[model samples]
Target: MFTRFRLASTLAEFLGTAALVLIALVLSEITPVSYFVATSLAITLAAIVFIFGPISGAHFNPAITFGMWTARRIGTLRATAYVAAQMLGGLGAWQLYQYLNDKAVPAQSVTFNTTIWLAEAVGAFVLALGITAAISRAVDSLQWAVTAGATYFVGIMIASTASAGYLNPAVAVGLRSWNAAYVLGPLVGALVAVNLYHLLFSPSAVPVKRKR
Candidate 1:
């Protein structure tokens, strides 16, 4: 059963991340408006979570995997495996996008700055906060999906000005923006977010009243 669960979870992460990256690449290319892209990505994320959350907790991001690991919610081996699978999935999606478009993958670059880093950090914080909140509440899969979608929409919209708003490290890999700002910012933000959630917002943190 343990082996079976591991296989299922790994496969789910690969496929879910692939789907997300592929859609994001296509949308980024065709959509002219950033708001529209953000909206589309949000809906796509909701759908992915609705479908895959039961199998693997729908973690398609390395930052999320890291956060879960830090919170001791997932084993270290599984977290490492998830991160590897997610990165491969991003690469797979990029290759697929190139083939579908019948074009070579173009060189992409972005300037890294404090603003971008801070934006990514803020965006990741919002995302991780929503995820942790949903988990703490033990919300149903549908509610979780909605929460994920809403948080991602808000995060992307807020961060798009200073950064591409690839709040997930896996998505950053897929987008070829694998810079320090894009990568470390989200990881740090998620780290803080998860810890903060557990420290202040988790049920355990709520003080219980003594009998009168």
Candidate 2:
């Protein structure tokens, strides 16, 4: 039973991440405006969360998985499995995109500087904040989905000023921008966000004042 559950969760992560990356790659090619692309991706992600949240908690991003693991909400082995599945899913989506287009994915030359890193960090921070809030509040899946989508929409808009605003390590890999700024920035942001949420916002973190 445990093994079966693990397999189910892993497969859910794989499929969810693949769907996200595939849509993102297609949107990048078709959508001319950044607003439209961000909107579409946010909607797509909300749908994914609604569909896959019951199965795998709908992480679909390594940054979220890392945050959960850091908060001790997820086990180490499971987190590793989810991250591996997400990366493979992104790669699989890229392959599918190439096959569908019958052309090579375009290479983008993005310089990674402190500004870009900070932008990515900020994006991930917003995303992580919403996620942790949902978990802490134990909101229903539908509400969580909306919160996730809204956060992604705002995060992408904020990050796109200095970067492509992948905001997701898996999506970055799919888009062929697997650099430190795209990877480490989000992870660091998630780490800080998770810790901050637990330390300052989580219910258990609140201090109870004694009656005077």
Best by lDDT: 2
Prediction 1 TM-score vs. true:
0.94
- What is the TM-score of candidate 2? 0.94
| Residue pairs of candidate 2 with colliding backbone atoms | none
Off by over 4 Å in 2: 207-212
lDDT of 1 by residue, 17-136 (tens): 999899888887887677998898899889988998888988888998898899998898999899999999999998899888998666567667889899999999998888888877
TM-score of each: 0.94, 0.94
17-59: candidate 2 lDDT, tens digit per residue? 9999999999888886879888999998899888888788888
